[model samples]
Target: MKVNNSNLDFDSNATDSESERAAVAPVVCLENIHKQFGSLEVLKGIDLKASAGEVISLIGSSGSGKSTLLRCANLLEVPQDGEIIFEGEPIIWSGSGFSRKPSDNDQVRKLRTNLSMVFQQFNLWAHLTILENVIEAPVTVLGRDPLQSAAFGLELLEKVGIGDKSDAYPSQLSGGQQQRAAIARALAMEPRAILFDEPTSALDPELEAEVVRVIKSLADEGRTMIIVTHDMKLAREVANQSIFLHQGLIEEQGDPEELFGNPKSERLQQFLSATASV
Candidate 1:
């Protein structure tokens, strides 16, 4: 499978009007995902799929489990009863419910390496310079050469419009710059897809626009990403498919235009109305 080559003559802003990866084999699949916290059920039988280069947006209210589902996809959060299929291969499971985890720890690590995450909080190491933060994972986990990773890190930073800030520490930059640097770090791994947990939630409107521009650029390049976002406009513009989750269950899902234009569920109708006001 020929994905967006991170090393080629990659133009972050270049739009690919060719066919989307909707027909490409799924890079990540969440089957019957169920999660709970003591007595509270966060996700119930949630199913999702992201094909190569396809961007899917997860939308819901504060407690609707969108973030939790995204975390489960990357196994940052464990789902008691669900199957995570990465590149079509299911992770080995050992137990049921709360005790559930991948039987093979090594496999879990390898699977996670491909499903990189960009958090609501930039989560950059405050002590490390932007370039160091970006190259850490590639050099440490992937065993990529530091020199090569540094070069790629600089390219990714430039792609996110923060190349000059590579030597700057997180605290020295604005919130938007930090988030863009975080995005550059996620891109450093050259993963199959990215799981964005509300990439713009932490920023003000002005700062949010900076990150959104980079996200739109990535979408145009056919980079597979599953984004958990509250920005309805962003969902409409960047996501090919939008999923509306209601109290841990998928209430509605389809093309963003169709789902937003003509919502089928009363719950979704109310949610849309509420978010529209925000």
Candidate 2:
């Protein structure tokens, strides 16, 4: 398989026939993206795309910029360089040389409502009931009708397999259950895509599968998703495509089967073999 830097843009219209091929329009496109924290450069010229309904898993060791890249996708972390187009609209860039003014609080809030994010720690409001936590943002932030938001929240909880936990508080639920509720909350907003950052990294093996199952179900239903994870097995099973980052740069990426089963990059091969050895 020949993996080159030429096809790194995330536009769905872009095409390349190297290893494995699939037909779909990319929902998320990143072109020449770069991020830095003072002197520390995290993401270096990242070009990637995800087709509608395609599941792309980001894998790399700690500090490889996987999480930073995911955050930039949803504008959670602003990039110093490059363009990010989500579902078609360019994410407002704040830094110099960008035409659009950086997104303000209100603009960013709206962007977030459309593109939901699920964190690893399951950032739920402990004081609120499961249902309330899910409905809070939609009603308070989006000004959605209370009744309609509640109904939607309930439906989402059920969809994520935790409808019965609506009345319980976060403290009352297990790690897996809490994560599921978080996912439901993200879904309630009806975002064009969901960004997951290490959703299952904190869970034990047994508990992890519950979250994985829900994610798999979402993929089956054709939900566009980008996940930053260390779980190679789950990535292999659920991801249609994969990206491997090394030292803050994309080392290799392609179909998960090709990347995992037969990686071409020396960095990727070394990383996989090391992971397997562990």
Best model per lDDT:
1
Off by over 4 Å in 1: 1-24
Q: Candidate 2's residue-wise lDDT over 43-135, tens digit each?
A: 889987765567789999999999999888778777888887765566665546333345566656766787788999998998999999999
Q: What is the C-alpha lDDT of each candidate?
A: 0.87, 0.82
Deviation from native of the Cα of residue 247 in model 1, angstroms: 0.5
Tens digits of lDDT, candidate 1, 40-84: 999999888777777888898999999999999988889999789
**Sequence-dependent TM-score of model 2:** 0.87
Which consecutive 10 residues in model 2 have the weakest lDDT in total? 1-10
